[model samples]
Target: MKKGRIILIDDDRDHLRAASDWLTVNGFEVLSFDRADDAFKAIIDQPPDLVLTDLRMPGVDGMTLLSSVVRKCPGLPVILLTAHGDVSLAVEALKRGGEDFIEKPYDAERLVGVLSKAIEKSRMSQEIGRLQRLVVQQDKEVGSIIGDSTAIRSLRQRIAALAQVDIDVLIIGETGTGKELVAQALHYQSHRAPAPFVAINCSALPESIFESEVFGHVKGAFTGALSERQGKFEHATGGTIFLDEIEAMPLPFQAKILRVLQERVVERLGENRLRPVDVRIVAAAKTDLSAEIAAGRFREDLFYRLASVDVRIPPVRERAEDIEQLFRHFASLAARRYGRPEPQVPPSLVVRLLQQEWRGNVREVKARAERFALGLDEEQPQQSAFSIEAPLPERVSHYEARLILAALGINHGNTAQTAADLGIPVRTLNEKIKRYGLRYSGET
Candidate 1:
């Protein structure tokens, strides 16, 4: 396999020919130029992975060419070929810009090894940058939010529309509903897409460093303050910041967060100056804000501020038609990863899958699909009844609505109490009532 492309330059024709012969024999495409200008002409037409040039030349010396290459392709690695007496100059060239250097009488193996290492390092950096850009591109679309159901389609459209409007957003969803994915889509499609999209898990950050992490800290701000640091807000300036599990944020910190939103700035720890910031907040929580507010665990004011626009991601049960499709997709991916053939789905398994309630939502469905693909789902049980004939989502909603109605009836039409009995939040229960177009008697 060809290692990669390299441009070799030396004023001595014999030296250029020798280096070219050795490199070509060792699996590299060597382009040898006897003059610096000749090599630069080729470098301008098509930049190579590595540049190898002599330190002393008639014109456009090695240092000048290396500087020019550095200016044009900052990431490209350049290695200098120097004489035994020019070791100091070679070291200076490295300090100036060159990646490494080898003496003219160096062994062919040592030269090839250095060249290979430099080219590989350059390629690795290039690959990382490409992948990072790809990740940003993927976030710009609905690629990560997979589903073809009507609810999912409508949600996608709403997300696209919301991306254009710069406003704080509140995402409401059950556990495993891909709330973070929605937040990413919002950031990548917005006008601030080029800026950073920083994500923080509110529940994961402890109280000890919460302030310093969110608002940053100046040097000597507190104990163990080694250097000035940029906080999540500063990193996300002019872009989006995703706060997952917003309900779990400490009450005092929640108040500060609200202030930051209102003030459009943050004061780092031990800093007297407030740095202005332009950021859009996208907050997510699995719990109901209304219940949290009623319970006095969350600030109602903060809720209103973060929820300038609200996005609700429907649970898997509500979009159950996507279950089979999601299952097949995940199974294929798992099979590829595991080096296993795609498992065949039996008709009975299809019925069994749709019959059971996916309590963990899409996340649970994904896990079960991977297990099924690995042939480890034989012990899993299926329960209850819902028609596979009707449009799958309709059947799911119909069954769910019936269950909620029954639960309400059993609880004598008390939504809060019924919600507790059903193991769902009152807010979620109310939304279900509205979605199913149902009314309970003896209720206002």
Candidate 2:
């Protein structure tokens, strides 16, 4: 590896030659200028890693050069050279903008030490700036994958670990389980986060256009190929391409995807030249891929190529403990979206929220929360008492059970208090509690 470049300037012909030669021998790329004007132009064009200037010169002396470098390249280091008698001038220059000063007849070892230390500091500062920007950008993307459950936390950690590696990822989950959110997390947290994140839904694309949609096409390749175009692979170079619902892709197209992953190259529909692409693959599926392979709907070889890492997202039913919290969070969001007052979650509603089977996972709960936030769940005049998923008799039973349990818990299992809360007699409330076989706050 080559050391950083150094710019050396002095009016002394021999001093310039000596300093340049010494730094070059010490593994630096040295540019020497007998006149400060020439060095100033070089610095303006492209600032070197370090600047070495003489304190006294005919025109554009060390102090002037140091001031100019400070303004142009704010963090750059400029070392001043001075005679032993001119030590005060060197000290003044250091206050103005000089990094350090070296007296005449300087030792080569000391000069090398000062220059190396300054260069290392500059490199460290640049690296810190890069990392700070990356953190701010990643925070926006990571905040969307919400949930404090163990499954969610573990999924975030795995996504972060996989993002750092250059491997294909297969995200498996049911519909509405936030598969797309997982994919975005992987792309935004990876080294390719700064690059474009292109997504395509395999199930939405048709067989007639799959080739052109994915791999681009040359002009006149087909009836609608009026102009040459780049495909998702070419567009996502140095980034990630999210292939959602990969199992929905036809078998023939699966063969093409396998080739792209294996070769890291693609060709336009009418072009013979293969274009090289550098992109990470993130595929998602809602079905059992192994079962699909057995049924001959999916290719085993393609699955292996894409599943270099597998990320399975658990359904909301498995995370039932998080339901109340998830519903409250979504309710707040719905209120913000509609510019309305956020509704308080009644205890009765909270009890019903916990009893849901959550077949649609987080998405379904969020929709129901929005209805509650808008006061449409209970108070809408045209709404039916029974949801389409349940019969009226079953829905009535569920409502009664949830209301009795909520009232019992809220009233500390006092029959009189529970009856008052439900607008019923104490005897009737007790009989209904027994009929439902319910337990509450004070139940043994």
* Candidate maximizing TM-score: 1
Please provide, for model 1 over 1-444, each residue's C-alpha lDDT reduced to its tens digit, 9 standing for 90 to 100: 899899999989988898899999999999998888888889988999899999999978999999888878788899999999999999999987899999878899998899999999999999989988775564344246788999999999999999999988999999988899899889888999889889999999999999999999999999899899989999899899999999999999999899888998998999999999999999998965999999999999999888878999999889878888878777766555455576777777888888878889887887777677555577323322455676878877876875676566446589999899989999999999998887654232
Candidate 2 residue 69 C-alpha distance from true site, Å: 32
Candidate 2, position 185, lDDT: 85
- Cand. 1 TM to true fold: 0.62
The per-prediction CA RMSD against the true structure, in angstroms, equals: 15.3, 20.0
Clashing pairs in 1: none
Q: What are the models' TM-scores?
A: 0.62, 0.55
